[model samples]
Target: MTSWVDMPLCAVDTETTSADPNTARLVTACVAAINGSEVDSRTWVANPGIEIPAEATDVHGITNEYVREHGRPHDEVVAEVVEALYVAWESGRAVVAYNASFDFTVIANHSPGFEVRGLIVDPFTIDREFDAYRKGKRTLADVCEHYGVRLDGAHSADGDALAAARLAWKMPRVYHVLALASADSLMESQANWYRERQYSYIDYLRRNNRPFDDVSVEWPVRTQKATAA
Candidate 1:
């Protein structure tokens, strides 16, 4: 039994300019945890080189103009974020993300020029694996709604990431009870499932008749405007 206290874990989340991991730029990143009644948090914002679209800006609040004026260099900030995340993992802790595939893919796409190694516990995939037969979908919001978890900050990277961490903490103990597999095993299982079964997570939810609610109806204030100066 892995007690939450015994688990060296960090929650990670990223808010990007778009949904495409290959093209979207990471605008914000955050890591946080609640340890025995004590909460700790860290966050960073970067100026992705690509243009921050109006639609994207409407969601995250970062604009190209503001980024140009106030944001740190994208690569430098990403390096810092990676360093912080790696430190947490190297210390024998697991990095947790709501939908790790999205975040990890984005990181990998942007980090081709750098090196990073760690296993991320993507609770999204885990939930789908655990609830494969339940029909519909298991989005972070849906899961949070089903489990009575309060989702704060919506699309803000830190807020979403922290919510994910809490959800990971509350994952039904039944999961941990099964074979105590390594993180690699879990990832492989998810990848195999995705490859073998063309399971679009959205389709899974629709089939299950689970309600799909938009996690963010409107963006947060984290983004800046790049409008005419």
Candidate 2:
């Protein structure tokens, strides 16, 4: 199949033990059409090796007992997933994810003994690039709601993957612009944009003699101790 963005673009996603991708196991995977049609789709449930916590189960609906009883062996399925990713990456198609960093990081971390390759396309990062003025939340549901796209199923990997693909189709201008940017260029653009914003903030502080230096510079919170606490 011709890739939606390039060649058979993979809309990959997973349900894991937790939010940390490294420690999380690939509970499921889905590949869908980037152009609003459902194509080859796949889902897998793995033992994860680690016990599935109730909270995680509550989120994705995969429970420890269910996985232990019906899922494939972890290593074998993970190997297959890795191989598929490598093939897609080699084919020059982008892997789509909502917050790609987390997904990529998780996949990379979990598939340590496996081999895979692919360039990742993260809508979260892309939004930061094109919609700098966009305010409020940017979850998949939010994007779907904003774009008038229907989110049929959520939480499941297949559903989220398809939703992400549809979200891409909804924001063509942003997607096309980023698709043309090299990875380095895209990251550099984000860095420069944030750098400018930081400078503006610093200048404002300096002009007002607001003791900006005394204010901590740590992200999420200005005060390191406060953040830690």
Candidate 3:
């Protein structure tokens, strides 16, 4: 039986135009394949066919002018990204991301025909579960720092994605329980972990008289509304 650490890992991430997954447009994306110590990465930049807001550009450092000059067509980039993910899945590798829900949701919305397969690993969810009581932020940079993983470019899709894969590789070494679980089991566990976190936050909101409806428990990607049959 292949241990979790020995299995191949495919990490995906995207830099988008907004924080809301429903509205954000993908500006850049990266998919990385990791086998033991070797990694191969591919990246794409697209002119999302919409304005790249100053705020979004500030985070990812990709300006509208720059993308217009260098990026490929939006649909073309989306297709390639989807194909990369499909290849990774077909290779029996686990797909990883730091905050998977946002990245996967944006991609699903953009590439409507693309369907993701294989095990999904989320370092963000796993970190929350393993260190539930730990204080402060849990951003990719923070988690990488905690695990002593080098994150060179910070918000760039390629940098963040590779760092996430490295962090996932380090997780089992730090948490023995993670080493005991298979990829499928870990995926299911992450779903439950996210649900518990959302419930706790909802309770806090209600206690403070704040609106807390519409929270989702889905992992990797939230369930979208179905078309009328």
TM-score of every candidate relative to the true structure: 0.76, 0.71, 0.93
The candidate that wins on lDDT is 3
Give me the overall lDDT of model 3. 0.85
Residue pair clashes in candidate 2:
3-7, 3-8, 21-106, 86-117
> With candidate 2 superimposed using the best TM-score fit, by how many Å does residue 38's alpha carbon deviate from the native?
4.9
lDDT of 1 by residue, 1-229 (tens): 3433346668888888887554677888887754655657788878887788889889878788977787778877777777877787777666788876567666766665544355566667667667777766677778877667778988887778877877766663546642365655554665554433333544555577865342211111101212111
TM-score of 2: 0.71
Q: Comparing 2 and 3 by TM-score, which wins?
A: 3
- Across 1-229, the per-residue lDDT of candidate 3 in tens digits comes to 4556657899999998898888888899999998768889899999898999999988999999988999889889988998999999898888988989889888888887757687888999999998999888999998898889999899999999999988888889899888888777777888889877877877777778887656666677877422111
Q: Give each model's whole-structure lDDT.
A: 0.66, 0.63, 0.85
Best by TM-score: 3
Model 3 residue 60 lDDT? 91
Which portions of model 2 show Cα errors greater than 4 Å? Answer: 1-8, 33-38, 113-116, 174-176, 179-229
Q: State the lDDT of candidate 2 residue by residue for 1-229, as single tens digits.
A: 2333443457777788887553577666665534335477767778888788888888889888888898888877777776767766676666677776566556666566533344555565556556767888878878778677777778888888887776655564545665566544544554454345455567777787675543322221112211111
